[model samples]
Target: MSLSIVDNGRELFVVKLIERGEKIDEHVQREIMNHRSLKHPNIVRFNELRNLERGVDILVATPGRLVDMIERARVSLRMIKYLALDEADRMLDMGFEPQIRRFVEQMEMPPPGARQTMLFSATFPTEIQRLASDFMSNYIFLAVGRVGSSTDLIVQKVEFVQDMDKRNYLMDLLHTQCDNGAHGKCALTLVFVETKRGADALERWLSMNGFPATAIHGDKVQMVS
Candidate 1:
């Protein structure tokens, strides 16, 4: 998943995984669907959901679609005061820079004090920096510290054991947790495994052991990455 945010002097965006098995097409569809119902004077409306080449499923969009909506036409740049580019780094990394450049070039220019532009990304490389510079005026370069080192939001708990013992150990741990009421109510626990075969084997073992667990990973499908 990718998210974009804007602020007084900076913007932030991030692209990270949700479920490894989720398809790019599905993710794009979900974002477009959610953005379609919004009605706000300050919101930059989503225009369209378009698929890339058949083999590459990421959704690329255009502002023209919003222009096509009679009632929503006011949501276009003629009404908005800012342009926010999300995942600016990944867009350049994945070769969408040219398309984005075209989009920016064609957008309606704002009056002298009318609009602001923001670009955001988790990791901005040299190329992305150059692209952002091209699209933005005087900007501040501010970066928070490295992701995990500063805040440690991701906690890594490790158990050293042989691979063969992992399944049994997992089942026992889960059973104990279940007995303690962790799995009795309506809650979710996610399990991740390295390989498709390993995921399948572990899922079966988990189900057989009476734990309702699901394993989703890269090997599940070509789009899983």
Candidate 2:
């Protein structure tokens, strides 16, 4: 969908809204890497409001920051050709509905039919449906797969191990998987830790045990190539 918008070769402007947090930084960094790799002239990388005046083909932002920019006259929604709300339900759940409504309804942006609006959510309740009715015109509802259900390719497993035994347990699991060839060469395994120190410790342990691992957290500087 984003490719189609970029390929059109028009003076495109897109606004992507998502929840904000430390975790969001990793996701944004990954996206920035992908965007840089594309090397498309039409795609402009925007991070701050000061850069918005130079021109942006796509703007990925949080509702609060976007609203602040709009109020500061740094961003004008009048030319926005595409507005996408990713994790729409999550944003609403996080009490961002007022900000969303302010930009979509009270701003200078084009009305529903005049501009393309895409709302993506894992689950849509009554409030979400009401938001759709209020913000969209003749929108088509398409369900790609069952909600709240994992795909067959994903195998869920649970193992109860004490904190003291976690490291050894993980080492054993990885060794077993390696022996079974479950994870081929260069396959990645992601493990989540509660804190930055824990992540660093785990990464060091994995590396010491002949496994290459990198830890990313808020404290670490992320470089996108």
Candidate 3:
């Protein structure tokens, strides 16, 4: 569910899923577990899932679980031609910068010429931009328009509710939207909650009320949304 499904699964975009308000939930837990089990040349693998006192830590490696796979002689990165970070802003926001820095630092003492580094984000802040600049070489700011702009093709809706009733409101809305031909034949609904704990609570409540739902948040990882 964290990955967006498009064109009948022809395109799979598992961008960084952010749960701004609540804590961890079953959905996030399952995704992390599933990702750990997946083995592929293009997939990112998480090996050691650590829950420290400060936060959760995912020892994720692009292409494979680097530390263990290298030791086990499973795969090699000799043919890797490019390095990319999807949901980069979310990664930094979730506190994976140190791990990322360490990974980049271990890139074999740097080869001749510049190793192309690219960053794409839905929202960019001045401070984050500065940090990204520090990590890249000869990067150019290539934004086309406003920072948090929306698309014309996308219809938007905004609703106001008291903080105490937000959860209930969201549940009611989801129920109504999904009920009997309202959402038009099994359309997936994406709900964005504020915190990891809130996400956990909401998913539980929805499930208890017989609504199929899931949530993902920072508390489930070594980062924060």
Per-candidate local distance difference test:
0.49, 0.71, 0.49
- Candidate 3 per-residue C-alpha lDDT over 53-93 given as tens digits, one digit per residue, 9 for 90 to 100: 12222222332234334345443333333344556677677
For all predicted structures, in order, the TM-scores are 0.41, 0.61, 0.40
Instruction: Give the poorly placed runs of model 2, Cα more than 4 Å off.
Output: 6-51, 54-57, 151-165, 168-190, 195-200, 210-225
With candidate 2 superimposed using the best TM-score fit, by how many Å does residue 67's alpha carbon deviate from the native? 1.0
lDDT of 1 by residue, 116-202 (tens): 666668886778678767777777676777632446586678889797788778777676666677446523567777778988887
Candidate 2 all-Cα RMSD: 6.4
In model 3, the Cα lDDT at residue 121 comes to 72
Worst 10 residues of 2 by lDDT: 7-16
Candidate with maximal TM-score:
2
Q: Write the per-residue lDDT of candidate 2 for residues 84-184, one digit (tens) a residue.
A: 77778888888889988998999887898887778888887888888888989988888878865678999888989999999999888787777767555
Prediction 1 global C-alpha lDDT: 0.49
**Superposition error at 34 for model 2 (Å):** 15
Residue 37 in candidate 1, Cα distance off native in Å = 18
